[model samples]
Target: MFEQEDALLTIDELCSILMIGRNTAYRLLNSDAIKAFRIGRCWKIPKAAVRDFLEASHTVL
Candidate 1:
């Protein structure tokens, strides 16, 4: 789903990749809709998790 070869992505990177806003990205994280973990005060999202989320979302729709 993403062209960038990053194992972990930051909130801004996630927003850029998904073409979504920071709030929306944070919402997903807070809701556990997209699996992520916090490193100190920063969130680290796995690329595979994002791919899985996209795939699951696509299937649901």
Candidate 2:
């Protein structure tokens, strides 16, 4: 049910979506916690990967 029209998002877009600072996003991108791809000099994150991360990390209080 988490289908998205766009599979990839720019770093800026990812930061906005995750509500994190650019540096934090970069850190996550660098770490294996999140997967990212480089196209030319820019990095792009897959929306599905983000969704999976969220789902896997979710915990009910």
**Which candidate's TM-score is highest?**
1
Question: In model 2, what is the error at residue 30, expressed in angstroms?
Answer: 0.5
On the 0 to 100 scale, the lDDT of residue 48 in model 1 is 89
**lDDT of candidate 1 over 1-61, digit per residue (tens):** 4666768999998999899999999999999999999999999999989999999999999
Q: Which parts of model 2 are misplaced by more than 4 Å?
A: 1-4, 59-61
For the record, the alpha-carbon RMSD of candidate 2 to the native fold, in angstroms, is: 2.7
lDDT of 2 at 24: 90
Alpha-carbon RMSD, each predicted model = 1.5, 2.7
At residue 55, candidate 2 shows an lDDT of: 72
- State the lDDT at 57 in candidate 2: 63
* Every model's TM-score: 0.90, 0.80
Candidate 1 TM-score versus the reference: 0.90
lDDT of model 2 at position 32: 56
RMSD of 1: 1.5
Per-model lDDT: 0.93, 0.80
Give lDDT for model 2. Answer: 0.80
